[model samples]
Target: MGNCCGTVIEKAGEMGKITLEILGGGEEIGRLSVLVSRNNSGILLDCGINFDENGNPQMPLYVPPKRVKAIALTHAHLDHTGAVPLYFVSSKIPTYMTKATKDVLRPLMEDYLHISGYYLPFEYEEIAKLFKNTKTVKYGEQVEINGYTLEFINAGHIPGSMSVIVNVSDKRVLFTGDLNLAETELVYPANYREEAKDIDFLVIETTYATTEHPRREDVEKRFIEAVKEVVENNGIVLVPAFSVSRSQEILVVLRKYGIDVPVYYDGMVREINRIFLSNKAFLKNHGLLRKAIKDFIEIRGWQDRKAILESGGPAVIVASSGMLRGGPSSYFLRKIYDREENGIFLVSFQAPNTPGRLIVERGIFEEGMVERIRARVEWFDFSSHAGRTELLKAIDDLRSSLEKVILVHGEPDVQRKFAEEISEKYGLNVIIAKNGDKIVI
Candidate 1:
């Protein structure tokens, strides 16, 4: 279980029975991959790239592509779908995801390759080829392949995000890929009502298991107030958001508060939003999205982005490379670091060692200045992941029917903490999955 890769078999002695394996995203927060097999047939969920401590791509130590028959992506987040192209280049398996995910993945992969300035593990041609082989599954439609039935329900984290329910041998396994239970103006809450009746094994994400987030109303209020303060001071408000869910979430928050000051969106977030618009079926509230489209101004090209920064004053700009890695956010940070009047608002979780966390923790500006930016630094807990209370509530809601609970997609300590809470409270079998840990129902 310690190894980062390779095929891990549990209950190997039970020959014809079904089994489950955690290939990635077990004791870590990124690179979500899992394998479910029954009677020689297999389905891979989310072949994603794992980030090293420095937020760079690190290949998994063990991944046997030969056994995989198909890949199903939950969404377009790099942590959830970055390594998908690698599978297309290295293996013969067909990949599955919504059209929106493929639309977002193309430009993101291209950008990744361009920034790294090295030969990508997979080529653009492979991405195209994989798209050709991809089997698009709409939400709520059950597809039966080789005696196994699978269905995807909206996970409410991002556009085209899904929580998968797989049934084999009369047992059901639910794989939640980055879920958000609270409803936002941007997206609707998860559709757990229909799937809650007969869930046997629940594989849930615990990314926010130890914290409590503010209510939607409170979050919008804080965000609007923060923006008002920055705007009144004639300061540029820089929001570092994840390219996918967080960016859209923030946009909805801003619009819901009726802040009509031209909000500019740059980087992959614009492109991703385009994809989301293209795949309207996966979105939670299409009406609200239409309203957002009618109101907001989107920054398209480099020139437009540069002009926005050069002429910045009292406008809300939502730009990505959320962690401030290499996108317009970094460039904007560099430009606005000297201004005491500007404010940088971090609305998403910052992974360790990333530029976003650095800016939040140590307010060092460019050229090694050790002074905090004169502008106010604010954090609003508007995360897409379910917070501690929501997590407990979700578990409590499923307590009677849920037999096995496997915690994944979080740090080891976080998983352990949540697992302990579930065990002590519900008396259910709570398993904190490690990388390569295999569990059987």
Candidate 2:
């Protein structure tokens, strides 16, 4: 939508019916999108891209924007917000998201363009246009729109990550966007107990639906120990992290465990962290976050990159393109992969056919064709999504008036199995949504 600050288009009269449609994020992990509407007045939840096994990114099914009154964004990750500016409609529909998300949206968008090398339909100017129509809201702040009332609360996935409660047609619908209920050193866990008020229907993420992750403390301890073993032996410790949340979270975890090493950060993590730190109000403990990253050094140029590579072990390097598909992480990995003393510690979930998963599962990190690397490769689940226990607990808190549960943003098999489990456990109607499934809530 292109037009801005126009008259509110209201959906009048009784709450005839609330229809929820899956535009994307129905069965797969990426391209999460949905439409909630009644009487032809609708709102967009998210429009992200899903990457195929070949590392190519694709958008979900199209939803016409003419009927959309507004767009609500959960966070700035590409999978959730990538298709926003590209899908332009004549009318400029205002966007609702946390300030941190609005702040980081530019860099992430630019990075997507740079990484993909594909010319998206929109230009850089459109990003500014998108921001112009943005109504940045603080966490837990309630804003009443023409057709719905939305409140964004902390989702604990990253800085400014949120779970949204949309009040439409006298129904409270909660959407948890890549949620984490346990607090990390940098993030505050989701507070559904307070924000999930009078929920009528729940659409939640099922990324970690069937799996239970290791305790945060235990995982941190193991990761630090692995890094320590490498650096202590004069080997370089490389971590390929997601630029948005995972990068900063790893730094916080390393700082928390008191891992004293030359932790050099490369790629866009510095800028993302700067934007995150600038908005202390959106952080769980900004002061602590500042202290956590105080000792780390940011890689500035090719010289710094070269120096770090030459310096070798007894150092820790965190780089972007978390999957090791591209970015400085790949260069660093290539330089050290043949050395047994060097270590590559994966800190997040690796999707199928990606380099990260290739290395973690098969000791290979190269793109396309895989090759054995002598360097150490270890993995610990550093996912931000809620595990089965966390998901159940979040759903339980909102079960009072929760009429239906739609599981999206997960593998089809996981969504189906988890749906069955949830339905049986809570005795609530659960839907394993497909790309175009429409249901009345």
Which predicted model would earn the best TM-score? 2
lDDT of 1 by residue, 57-102 (tens): 8644245667676778888777787777777666667777777777
Q: List the residue pairs that clash in candidate 2.
A: 1-89, 2-91, 2-92, 3-91, 3-92, 235-313, 236-313
Estimate candidate 1's alpha-carbon lDDT, on a 0 to 1 scale.
Answer: 0.75
Per-residue lDDT of model 2, residues 1-441, tens digit only: 111111122332125677777878977888998878777667788889877666667887776677678888899988899888855534478889988998999788876776675547677666767888889888768887776888888898888878888888678888888899975767878888887788888889999899998788888889988999998899999999988878988888877778887898888888888998898877766765687667888888889989887777688999987988788888888888888998998886788888888887777765564458988888888888889999999988988778778788998777777877777777787777777777666
In model 1, the Cα lDDT at residue 47 comes to 66
Give all candidates' CA lDDT scores. Answer: 0.75, 0.81
In the predicted model 1, the residue pairs found to clash are: 5-62, 6-62
Q: Give candidate 2's error at residue 176 in angstroms.
A: 1.3
Alpha-carbon deviation at 293 in model 2, angstroms:
3.2
Candidate 2 lDDT trough over 10 residues, lowest sum: 1-10
Counting clashing residue pairs in each candidate, in order, gives: 2, 7
